[model samples]
Target: MSESNTPEQNSQPASATPPKQESLLANLLINIAIPALILAKLSGDDWLGTKWAIVVALAFPLLYGLRDFLQNGKANFFSGLGVVSILLTGGISLMELDAKYIAMKEAAIPALLGIATVVSLRTRWPLVKTFLYNDKVLDTDKIAAKLEDNNNLGAFELTLKQASWMVAASFFLSSVLNYVLAKVILTSPPGSEAFNAELGKMTALSYPVIVVPSMIVLILAMVFLFRRIGKLTGLKLEDIMAAHHR
Candidate 1:
């Protein structure tokens, strides 16, 4: 005979699904290209004007961040910083502040990250692991197990500490580049059409100027970490990397 389940059994919570990953193209278009285009092309006397243009350009990133958070069902450190950065930019432009403030704002984010990356080395969790050596890209659990078996776990930690410094260097590089780029590009006074166009120019240039160099350093750091992991654990690169990457 078939039996019916109790209400308690039937009311069990559904399994939680993984958070959706943001697409790189969508992120770039929303945060960089579209905003830059709007600020550059639309910020004119006949178009959106200085105030409205800043508002509209900043809105894309703000809305995109909100949507990403909603899709993930949580907040992240970088996303929170992005929101703060947007607010600061909007506030400065709307208030017609000095152009230097915008440059400082651009530099501050990466500077803060560089400081945090250095400081986190003293703690149990290093930012290097979060950025490079994490399970998202590496078979961390397997590597850890192998390290333990080989009595190289302490050695691995030392290697991670070195890699953390390298990561910090990348952040510092980005911070310097950001400041210089901003100081050079954002010369026009804030809340002017010329200033808006300059802001757009800075945005367009930032990817190739600041981001690419920082990314190269990060890639080098990752390679260094992987090589050290292989030496310590005697694992092949194919085995060291996560299944998805392989």
Candidate 2:
């Protein structure tokens, strides 16, 4: 006879063993420092010529992204987007374009993304799920069951649509910020040391400039959503949010 593991033996609590979170230092070093340093120090110099140096600098993020994808067995949506953006930047740099071109380039990505997010709302499976739902973040199945039991599924989905609109608006805000930041910071010609330095500066500032604000918006959206869920399903916040399990 085979024995099945009891909940006591099988369960691992989220609080007991916290998920390992990425560190700020690691994020800075890998995402900003390594690429920025190489570009600033060697990009405009005669070492590999400006063109190839840009390529090498671009390679750092690409290699890192590829390694992550291979290790994870799939490229994450954001990482894949980052790689595409890197390629675009590299191409623009190699073209010997002016700073405004780079500025336009920088803005293009977020603008397109913002547009896409809003457009996706029209589809059956909205892209909000990628940002908000999924097993890693919350147990959608459990929430759905609760909603069904409470006869609040329709109302819950409408609430999600409202939340999704707020999210789209945040992306649009990011797009404007991205454009302005790039336009202001990247004032030197591409392939110049000053240009590379400005690029470095842009990378360094992006967290405070973009990420912090975006996260605040996201948190507000989450709060709004959970509050509605609480009202509709009459579930505690903890009950609606997934339990940490191992």
Candidate 3:
């Protein structure tokens, strides 16, 4: 009877099964569905007045807030600001039927992100670090020891700071380019004309053209900086990416 009881205790029932992996539904919604809806709505003939455009543009940040709430339990300040800026500029364009707001939209998103990046660098919180890498399992003592021994914390902070500045600078330059394109190439007026021409150009170019290149440049620069720093610190790019994915 003891032998029989031991077998019963050791053997588990076959009815239980492992939990299913989480779906990629949210990723789909954000990356594909939302952008599609925004593009479709913007392309439509219906009048997207200033108020409506503002409301719609504001939705981006709100959605991001919702995403943060669901995923991380906190709203991201920088991402929220970027969303708001995009909406503000986009709304302005829609209301006046000008293209300046639309053109500015291209510049606004990156600029806002850049600002957020700078603000985040000032704190010991490592806000961007949290976003790009998962440091949850990191040993505080180890990290503290590393920070103490290495004089490179200042350098690391500067790298992040400069990277953020670069993003803002790039966006500012892009905005200026768009402005010039509107005034000289498209013959757009300062306010409404520029807005309209900018919208037309954005429509033709698409958001990817503007966003992808900027991000690519930013990431590449960051990677190069990371590599240089890592060589000195004995860290690896894979380590950063793994932390980010987690």
Candidate 4:
């Protein structure tokens, strides 16, 4: 006869299964391509109509967020926020207001992130570290040891905080560009084919229009950061950037 089972025995199956996670490209397709496609191809006076198309298109992103929550028992920050943004964007579009509301929705996300980046400086973990210095890009452990060896840790942290301000500036710049791009391109009243077509154009142009410039700023931040790190640690630039190659 078997011995009496404990609660831990019964819970093993649930805990042992690996969680399902969506791929980055899949997530982007769900969020950006699906919505843009539905709006561009289906949203028109003769098709699903603007209101219904927007509602239907919005469902794809919401489903992505729901899937994330179900598997992990929690939502990813960007994923959850993407779903909420879609809801707000859809709701605003359905309000029969001018096109500017959509433009505002587009701008609000980056603007808020910029504000949060500035606010995070007051906390223990500055957002700059995650953006530019995390394990994926830069090895904090190796740098920490180097800093301790050289007695440069304090100065390094100070440099990171200063870099965070520049990061915030880049985000604010993107926020302004986002608003202006939407206004200039999204002139057709919401829900029309012209509107949907323009939306597609904006989506297509975003990489070149907004992302390229923002990346230039982020690249500059990385350059300034590495240069400071080298100065503080007395390490060669190649030695300091070994974190990236590894």
Residue-wise lDDT of candidate 2 within 88-140, one digit each (tens)? Answer: 88888778677776678677776777677778878987777777765555656
Q: Which candidate is the best by TM-score?
A: 1
Which pairs clash inside model 2? none
Window of ten residues with lowest summed lDDT in model 3 = 12-21
Q: By TM-score, how accurate is candidate 1? A: 0.89
lDDT score for residue 84 of model 1: 93
Query: Best-fitting candidate, measured by lDDT?
Result: 1
For residues 116-215, could you state the per-residue lDDT of candidate 1 as single tens digits? 9989989888898789888767888889999999999899988988998899999899999989998998888788999999988888888999999999
Residue 14 in model 1: shift from native, Å? 23
lDDT of each: 0.86, 0.74, 0.48, 0.76
Q: Model 3 Cα displacement at 92 (Å)? A: 2.5
Give the alpha carbon lDDT tens digit for every residue of 1-246 in model 4: 012245644664365433313365766677678777887888777788777777777788788788878978875776677778777877777776688987888888988888998899899887887788776555556677889999998898889888898898888888888899999998887757677667766765666778779889989998999888878877776665433242
Arranged by TM-score, best first: 1, 2, 4, 3
User: Where does candidate 4 clash, by residue pair?
Assistant: none
* Candidate closer to the true structure by TM-score (higher is better), 2 or 3: 2
Which residue ranges in model 3 land beyond 4 Å of their true spot?
Answer: 1-72, 115-144, 150-164, 167-206, 236-246
TM-score winner between candidates 1 and 3: 1
